[model samples]
Target: MLPEVNATRYVTPLREGGSLPGIVEADNHGTYVVKFRGAGQGPKALVAEVISGELARRLDLPVPELAVTHLDPIVARAEPDEEVQELIRASAGANLGMDYLPGALGYDPVAHPVEADLASRTLAFDAFVENVDRSWRNPNLLIWHGDLWLIDHGATLYFHHNWPRAGNVAQRAYKWDDHVLRPYATNLATAGPALAAELTPGLLEEVIALVPDEWLAEFDFPSAEQARAAYLGHLRTRAAAWPAWLPGAAA
Candidate 1:
């Protein structure tokens, strides 16, 4: 389970994303980018951040620390913006909090070149996860302290949005041409196999268990355990079908 903390202060809103995640100070003395349960995307987005973000971290990828933040909503009283106050008041329970990375710059493929090795691995990872948000227009990556960090995984795991049709898209192909790091993913063929090998069923189950039951309760499955099984099944299927969906695998 992710460490839980009480939100001490609502700093400001990050208007870049549709969900309106905010910079919040927590009782743990941590500054986090808190994805609220009241956001338009709702708690499911927070679940994605946990499952996908934590999965990325276990894959030897750089992702900020993630936690379960308990919001009181009363903290919204200080906010002058009605929209923000409404959002805060709506999310009076558990939210997802990602450790804030200060001084990080948004990734620009042309300006900050990534090595072929890392690019291939990143592309392969994204492909296996079926992430459709890492396009050049909105890379969803950051460069901090001369290192690449992945963020904003709320867009991954789209299958959960419609449970009944998940099987139909589990093995869906990923297009890499528009991928922000496509040019540098020269070793994707090998990267695909190597990374997929890391996703053992045990590892997948472990990662899925990290999601709080409160978030998992939203799924239509008979129980949260079944929901976890669904995610595990989808990912295991996708991981093994890398030959079909992993971009550049044929090359």
Candidate 2:
């Protein structure tokens, strides 16, 4: 489970994405980019964030620290925006917080080229998760201290939105032509298979177990346990058929 922290202050809204996640100061004195559970995408987005971000970290991809944030609606009383205020009030319980990375710059492919190994691994990871947001227009890749970090995983795990047919989409092919790191993923043909092999049942459960039960309860399942089982099954199925969807997968 992610560490729990109480939000002490709401600094400013980051207008980059639709969810309007904001920067916050926590009781632990740590700064974080908090994603509210009341966001338009709902708690499922937060679930995807925890699963994908932490899973990426375990796989050696750079990801900011994720924590379960406790927020009080009163913290936004002075905010002028009605929209922001309503969002704060509705998110009066547990939300998601990611450690704020200071002085990080947006990644520019031409200015910051990645090595083949890292690029291959990154591409493989996205493919395995069925991420659709890592395109050139919205790379979602950041450069902090000369290393690349992946962010905003809410857009991955698309099948969750339609649970009944999730299995149909499990092994669906990943179209990587527009992937931001496609050009540099020279070793994907070799790396993809090796990386897929790493998503064993044990490791999959480790990452899935990190997701909070409250968030899992919102899914269209009989119980939170079933939701977790669904996620496990979907991911395991996709991982097993990686060669069908993974670009440059080896024979």
Off by over 4 Å in 1: none
Q: Which candidate is the best by lDDT?
A: 2
The C-alpha TM-scores of every prediction are 0.97, 0.98
Model 2 clash pairs are none
CA RMSD of all predictions: 1.1, 1.0
- State in Å the error of residue 115, model 2: 1.3
Write candidate 1's Cα lDDT for 1-251 as tens digits. 78899999999999998899999999989999999999889878887888889888999888999999999988999999999999999999999999999999999998999988888888888887778899999999999999999999998888889988999888888877799999998887787789988978888888899998878887577788888889899888877777788775665
Candidate 1 backbone collisions, by pair: none
TM-score of 1: 0.97
Give all candidates' CA lDDT scores.
Answer: 0.89, 0.91
Off by over 4 Å in 2: none
lDDT of 2 by residue, 98-145 (tens): 999999999899999999999999999999888899998999999999
